[model samples]
Target: MKMNPITLIIVLVFLYPILKGFLFKFSSRDLKCDIDDLSRNISFIIAIISGTYFGKKIFIQHDDGIYRNIYNHIPQQILDYLENNNLIIYAIVIPIIVFIIYRVIKLILDLLNYVTTYPALDSIEKFLSSKGNIFKRTTGMIFQIPKGLCYVLLVAFALNIMSVLNVSSKLNGYLEGSKPYKSICKSIIMPVTNSNIAKKLPNILNNSFRIVIREADSGRQIEPNSDTPATLNQTNGRKTVVYYNGVTLDQGVKSDPQIDKLAVALGSEGTNTTEKAQMLYNWIGTNISYDHDKANKVLNNDFNVRSGAISAFETRKGICFDYSCLYVAMARTNNIKVRLVTGEGFNGISWVSHAWNQVYIPESGKWINVDTTFYKGGNYFDNPRFSIDHKDAQIAGQW
Candidate 1:
């Protein structure tokens, strides 16, 4: 008969002691001890609290109590099939999981009790006579540590699987935070890895530029020529000193220590801002590709840039926002001043909302516009003519 979940929980609580007593007998028989009633009760409480608290955190709460985020990642057709047969799956699965948990907890408690009551090694030899011959006693002690570790790993693997499916905590966020450390290892293996490079330079060079021509529906020139003096640069009114001295840890531009490592590697060979900026521009322009799918979705809503830098580096694909965020991440991490600019620009055929960067040059005391996306058309650096087609929407954030 179907029962309320609250009733089921109360029933389990009342039955815990009966289960504990049965488990205690098996465990004490193995350890050859009369484990105290108080000690066993305490151990039981500790185990229940730890397992329940951690289990609740690992399993996402839902109407049914708890679940994995399997529904989010799986295809609709597969989910439909699973939903159609869920009762059969649960009937087969629940009992097996319960039995496994019972055995694991029993093993854990047995090990705990054994260790807590363990005598001195010299005393152990004397006790061996009461338990078994020395051979059986020695074998158990020898394997116990490794056996405990294996169970620990099994538990950890199960939790990790849950964590991966649960979107509240992102796997990519951990990787992004740790990328700097990985870059150090990468630096060590650079020479050997470089020799095996399979990406053809010719394909990259040939695919660098594209031309688009759009016939104007109105016989007028697509853009009105402006002799209007360029609008005051965003940097013009601000204290330039702050750009050099202050840190702007802008929210969307998430950076890690690895960017410092990357900056040193890329710009260490060049002394000037022009060279450093060019190096950064080239790396981003060639290494990353526009994410067509995400870009299409973004036109309908918005985009997230919190992990944009690492995501672009890992996937090698992103929209204009990703390009700008990654640029700012590396530049700021390395103590360079970079601003993410949101604006309107002609995407060859028609005007579209876009994002790019303006980098501060220390020696020149001026800002230079650099567009990685426009670099696809070649010659994107320090172009005065660039402002003619691109109009600033508003500056998002700067570092």
Candidate 2:
């Protein structure tokens, strides 16, 4: 037997989760104590979760490059639509759907096996006085397979139609698919066949996405409503507090040599969001460096402004938390009400953990997020870049 990876994977995949469930059954005995009772159930559940994860990752990754592959492949359109806001599909829905199907299938198989041995497992038996329920359990299987097949066919037919239509413009959205759709599809046709396409997808999507989003958002019209939402709350106040404290002390020493250097470098407050934004921007970028990379330790760190912005008039390397704190302190010093913004940056990469700051301009009365990281080419600013579509960007433990 030639053991191909795909075949080996298929066999192991089915058994692994069932093995884990049995391990659970043996490790902790309860209603799940019956091994025979759960073996088929667990197998069905595993298939469902795998399907759901496959569905959700599709939409989030954006649309595909090929023609036929559009709805069926990784960048599939149908999966995106059904999967959006449907997180439960991954963690529970798929498993439930699979469980129901398998439960029915197993019963039918059991009944069929019984008929082969006894010629008829469907005979009505004595009530509770029966010697064994094994014989009793065999009675219900005959009708389930027909209903299960019908149910399976209906769902499969609907999903197939949805998957096909998703690639069509009639239902789902597409990225400008590329600078020009023809070029991108052509570029991918051969490489995709060779399996080199997945590595290039991020840049390809990035290139084509700006045009796509601009097209998508431009058509959106909204009735103007006057509702002021509160600023994004902070996870810690110490960063905000110490920044203002540094600024408070900086005010007295404004004429001192150290203060004069940064003041000139940052410029006057009335300049511009673009310009005044620079004073804080440059200070953070050039001064703060990632402190062994943990935001939770911000308060306990000893580097302070002395080894940071105060010392380096120009620096561009800091952790997301450090970059955010530097901007907060500098902006507050500029007399602006600065807020620290912290969040997940991309795809739950714990390493993508980040922070930035938002400031309120008295004239506009709106909180504008400022990302020294993005401005310095470090991390992306999710809100400005995608509004909210950037799943990788999360606002975690904001301060």
Q: Candidates' TM-scores?
A: 0.37, 0.32
Per-residue alpha-carbon lDDT of model 2 for 1-399, expressed as tens digits?
Answer: 555432343345444444443333212122223323443443343334333333333433324554235446534464455555344443454446555666676676556544552332223222423545443233223222333333332333233223222334322122121122223223432233221222322221221100000112233322211131112122123112122212222321223345455654675743765457656666555455543322223333332343223333333434444455556556655666666543433211011233456767666667666665444333223233322212322322222
The alpha-carbon lDDT assigned to residue 355 of candidate 1 equals 67
Q: Write the per-residue lDDT of candidate 1 for residues 117-153, one digit (tens) a residue.
A: 5544335546544664445434444524333333332
Worst 10 residues of 2 by lDDT: 206-215
* Candidate 1 residue spans exceeding 4 A from truth: 1-249, 302-307
Best-matching candidate per lDDT: 1
Each candidate: RMSD:
22.1, 18.8
* Model 1 residue pairs with clashes: 180-258
